[model samples]
Target: ISSHVHYSGTREDRSSRVVETIEFTTDRGQTVRANPVVSDTGTVDRSGMSVTVLHDRDRPERFIAPQNGHGISARVPVMRIGFGLLFLVVIGIIVNGGRMILGQLPFF
Candidate 1:
């Protein structure tokens, strides 16, 4: 697998993106090139990295690279906690606003 960094947009709005290309030989002795599956960290100058390719039995050209799967990482948990906190804050604001509106009502 070959990884390359691609830049898009003008100077003001430029963004960097990583693309991974995989070259493999099919059973029929045909060389095929396809994009490999990559994780978010795949773009960090990890060029010429070796990756395991899982190809389709019928269509050898169609393939995917599964990222290493284990338990939850620190990044995911932090994101979840942040989103949960944001949700709670929003819910709390809505409930507080409703309570304020009900307090203004003539009927307690």
Candidate 2:
């Protein structure tokens, strides 16, 4: 197996994405090469990285790479909490502004 960085986008905002592809022989003596989907934890140097794959018995081409068993990235959870707090703040401001507008009406 060989690994390389896959760069995407224009020169101003280029992003470095990493992907891993494996070459293996099936039980029936067929050679197969495919790219495997892995988690995104930022730029990864998969160069010379060795991994073990488990192939499907029914379909030899199908395979899976065992995960490291770690949970989601730290940035994901932090962003979720940040967005939630921001949403609450916006809602509170909208409600308060509406009440203030209503109090200034002639009906009051």
Candidate 3:
């Protein structure tokens, strides 16, 4: 991303206009190159990984994958901690309000 500004004239009557450009360029050269050009670089192979599965008739049982449980039960203790802090804040507010109206501290 780039911006170019052109200023015409001196301080009293100066005027400027900005030209901005935002782009993506793959290759750079002295001259602008046009696309749709093909080269004779042999063959472009785009084949990726291949997976094969074989079944045997003599096997009595297939493989069983181990189960990975979710994080809900593990996160319950953290939620309980946050709830305990919130309850403490509410109780402190109630105690302070009662002490303010009663004209004395809640606990001496």
Candidate 4:
């Protein structure tokens, strides 16, 4: 079923979190209400919009929202920068070690 979504708050890095509750019935006649948190993106605020949810038959409590993967995550860019810095550090160490070894050679 569809439920209204509201912006709960933002993450540590200032990324927004949009949360919505999904109500559904399980195969075993169990009623489950799942609240799925998604990233708030786009030019408009989706606070009043409804969200769709998909649940596992075996485990009704385990559910997911289609919008979860719809946008680029806030962590992607930061992770890329972190990896790039790590690569540079590794290359610097390798180059320095190679220079030290080659400098020990008697041949000019």
Model 2, residue 17: C-alpha shift (Å) = 0.7
* lDDT (CA) per prediction: 0.71, 0.69, 0.38, 0.62
Off by over 4 Å in 1: 9-13, 37-41, 69-108
lDDT of 2 by residue, 1-46 (tens): 5667878999999988666677877777877788654444355555
Tens digit per residue, CA lDDT, model 3, 19-78: 322222222312221211211111222123121212122331221111121111334568
Better of 3 and 4 by lDDT: 4
Error of 3 at 13 (Å): 88
True-structure lDDT of candidate 3: 0.38
Which regions of candidate 2 deviate over 4 angstroms?
25-30, 38-42, 66-108
- For all predicted structures, in order, the TM-scores are 0.53, 0.51, 0.30, 0.40
lDDT order of candidates, top first: 1, 2, 4, 3
Output the worst ten-in-a-row residue range by lDDT, candidate 2. Answer: 64-73
Which pairs in model 3 have colliding backbones?
none
- How many backbone clashes does every candidate have? 0, 0, 0, 0
Which has the greatest TM-score? 1
Evaluated at residue 104, the lDDT of candidate 1 is: 98
**Candidate 4 pairs with clashing backbones:** none
What's every prediction's RMSD, in angstroms?
5.1, 4.9, 23.2, 7.0
